[model samples]
Target: MNPLSRIRNFSIIAHIDHGKSTLADCLIQTCGAISEREMTQQVMDTMDIEKERGITIKAQSVRLSYQYQNETYILNLIDTPGHVDFSYEVSRSLASCEGALLVVDASQGVEAQTIANVYIALENNLEILPVLNKIDLPAANPERVIEEIEQTIGLECNQPLCVSAKTRLGIRELLERIIMQVPPPKGDPNAPTKALIYDSWFDNYLGALALVRVKEGAIKKGQRILVMGSNKNHEVLGLLYPHPIKQQQTEEIACGEIGIVILGLKSVTDIAVGDTMTDFKNPTKEAISGFEPAKPFVFAGIYPIETDKFEDLRDALDKLKLNDSSLTYEPETSIALGFGFRIGFLGLLHMEVIKERLEREFDLSLIATAPTVVYRITQTDGSTINIQNPSELPPEQKIAKIEEPYVKATIIVPSEFLGNIITLLNHRRGIQEKMEYLHETRVLLEYLIPTNEIVMDFYDKLKSCTKGYASFDYEPYEYREGDLVKLDVRVAGEIVDALSIIVPKSKSYDRGKELVVAMKEIIPRQLFEVAIQASIGNKIIARETVKSMGKNVTAKCYGGDITRKRKLLEKQKEGKKRMKSIGKVNLPQEAFLAVLKID
Candidate 1:
């Protein structure tokens, strides 16, 4: 086992497309961790969905051995996601590291997520190392970027490492700098075994595997370990160092090292993320603290397109939960969409990724309802409850007040689009907090906005207004009392619970109208007229109708008495009335998506 002084545990943090994963690939190649023939681009992103989306959803860890001065030093590199949706993943990665490489694009000086990650790293007390990536590009401006980082983020930039990850420039020097600049992990090897499980996943052959950082002591093969979170003890069946190509099996994971622990359990639920694992016989004094669980920001109902696929959907979610602990779901039946599950996600991107995975991985066609934020409701009896779906909202007369989640959003855009962006934010009920000019061309704006306002199309709008130049990031701030009411959509005079949403009272009229109009274009015309109405507690606020298909019954009675033609038309009307009473509208999948499309 290597001593604490020879080990460096660090992570890569940056905004999306700033080249975190690519730099990781270069580092892995530089250290000879994987053969050139076996190496692939972004090898750390294992999931097909991640590779297809070109984003990192889960934080990945690899142990690299670097030889310098005739001595081998072990560098545990944790590559984290750059998107705001996966900031929780970054936070978890930071908690397990002593230092972080803050990668900023040489062209795009400082973005929103770069600032957000710096704050997270600072909170974790990680030594921040500034690196200017993509220096080979034509737009590269190292001197300007260096000045911006120092001025905007206030990070030291006296001697920033400038390199192009794609071209492999200055990679060897960057590796050397890591050894010289980053501090070694501090821990006692003689203390009792104490490890923090930052990540865990279900393996087909290995059952449940936990990727952990040994904080205080050693974890050995065949040793009994206690999971402090669940208060359960299990025997360690195997130990392996995490690698992109292949995990190297080890007899022990010593202090100041990271490795995977294999417990012969059939399900991932047997263990939990952020749990403290220690020696069963010689337990630690306290469990690892300061590990906050991932809190879901958006909630939506996902149902299988086919009713019989309900069980299949359940099975798929069960397997998926093994990999993603941030995902939460519970069985719920919708009157309009039938049996489904109400799932919670960190953000819209997370929702989209999970939905895509369910379809691509499990071969299940699914429909997701409009996403909503959790609302804290106070009842007339002085009781309070938190709800994600509008269907779960209590009766209007029984409620006292409602509080909606708010977020502190950071947006960085070019100066030319600042006015348009500010106008857009104001429309979403955003209150300006601070605005600054990072330089002559770029502007950074901070605002407090309702979480629900940005849940659907706010990001898209921001991108359009800025001509795709805005970088946005947000974190949950607090819940504030909001004047909100639940808006219910009715098709053919029957409430469609899955299409319901909670919106601000001031915007309810416009939202209701917009919802009905959007639904009118999607709901197919039936044999009888279908009434689409939006209402708040039985008071109809907006209504639209899909005209019935015209059938000329009177044409059959040509040249007969006018009364005879009239009699035939009357009979047709009666038939239409009867059909309207019993006929059900088959809501297309787009009908569910329409709720998301409404502004």
Candidate 2:
């Protein structure tokens, strides 16, 4: 067994744009992990979309070597996403680390996402140290932000380190604090070779790469190990530390260290995050605790723009899901959308990321239906069905009751906008659970809201209502009986399953009308009239018509006698009638996409 005493494993957590990636780059540069000449901005944010959006989309691991007090220490850093949607990434990263740096913006102070992440780190028993970032800014106030963190997140701000991540100011001292305060990992190196699989992703050739924290023993190349959660045994094909730019090959990753295990398993399910790995022959009796799989909270339908490219879309999704385990999908077909897949995600941002990645990476244009939540339907025969796609919902007559998922949400906003936020939440059917005033300026509002209510454009609305000063976080709660009905949109008297949504009974009429009006503008006008109708069961709530395109039938009757003009007009009317009776309204890809961005 190899003893590693001078090793530190930690994650840098903060709200978006609070210098998480910048701080990570400084650490890497200072540790000389990568040459200064090669250092690029936001090196940890390797994804092109992440660079463009100015946010970290995925959790990235970087290994560094630091020398302090004449001793070389190994530092393993996992840079996690700051958005609440990606909090699951932070949780899994926390399981692999011994401590975390709770970074708060000196200018903006602590936010909702930071508080949510702090609780997750606490649950993992990770030592958390405070770091006030961006102190070089003119409006920076570390003292006020420290007080806010203590008041809102319940974390002591004693001796909080202030650093300007952009200028590399106080970063050396921050690293010193990490070594002095963050405790060394505690585990038995000689006991049955145990490790925790914190994260995994797929590679084109190497297959699944499991990023692991060696808890009790060393993992070397050619070592046979078993992933307890997946119950699959495979040999470690390669061993390397996770680098930002490239994989740094290592002879072995000993206990108290973090590294990647190349299992070469083709399937993502074969290597589950939070699963435990142990030596095949000397397996441990119990797998690690706190290894629950992340469940999808929001679901939507994804279809290719072209009907003939359905197989291309399916193949792309299969390849994408091989790397994105959080993304779940199944086959689905629609009368209007042709063939596609019903995909589930952690949040709206997750759904967007998946779509963007699919398009940018695979070059496949697609249309995603309006997002929906899983509905639990109890039938008259005492049977239960879980509907992921609204089109799959059972008939209202067969459903004895429908249970809709709810979420316990936390929202933080400036006190001045409290009234506006309250009104907004009320309109969304959110029930106030609790409220607290933090630091006399910001208010923390907790609400119990329907999961389906907030997934669509709630975040965008919340940000707009509060002038981008509000933050929201939520978790799934128990489902309750809801007055829910499936709202269907009919195009030219044909039900378009792609535009169906499960909405509250009370809002069905308004929502149905909204859908009808929105689709009316999206569907193109043809030579024959087309009716866009929105309905609930057999009742029509709203109807609109895409007016027929006019043709100059009379223009053909040139030296027009009154009888000739009349004959041409009558012939045109008959032609329109025949077209309306036989012509099918084939909605284009834009029609299905319109529902996602519609008000």
Predicted structure with the largest lDDT when compared to the true one: 1
- Residue 396 in model 1: shift from native, Å? 1.9
lDDT of 2 by residue, 41-130 (tens): 999987898999989877999888888999888889999998877888888899889899998889999887888888999988999999
Regions more than 4 Å wrong, model 1: none
Worst 10 residues of 2 by lDDT: 590-599
Q: Give the C-alpha miss distance for residue 233 in model 2, angstroms.
A: 1.9
Tens-digit lDDT string for candidate 1 (115-171): 999999999899899999999999999988998899988888888999889999999
Off by over 4 Å in 2: 556-564
lDDT score for candidate 1 against the true structure: 0.92
**TM-scores, one per candidate:** 0.98, 0.96
lDDT of each: 0.92, 0.87
The per-residue C-alpha lDDT of model 1 at residue 292 equals 66
RMSD of 2: 1.7
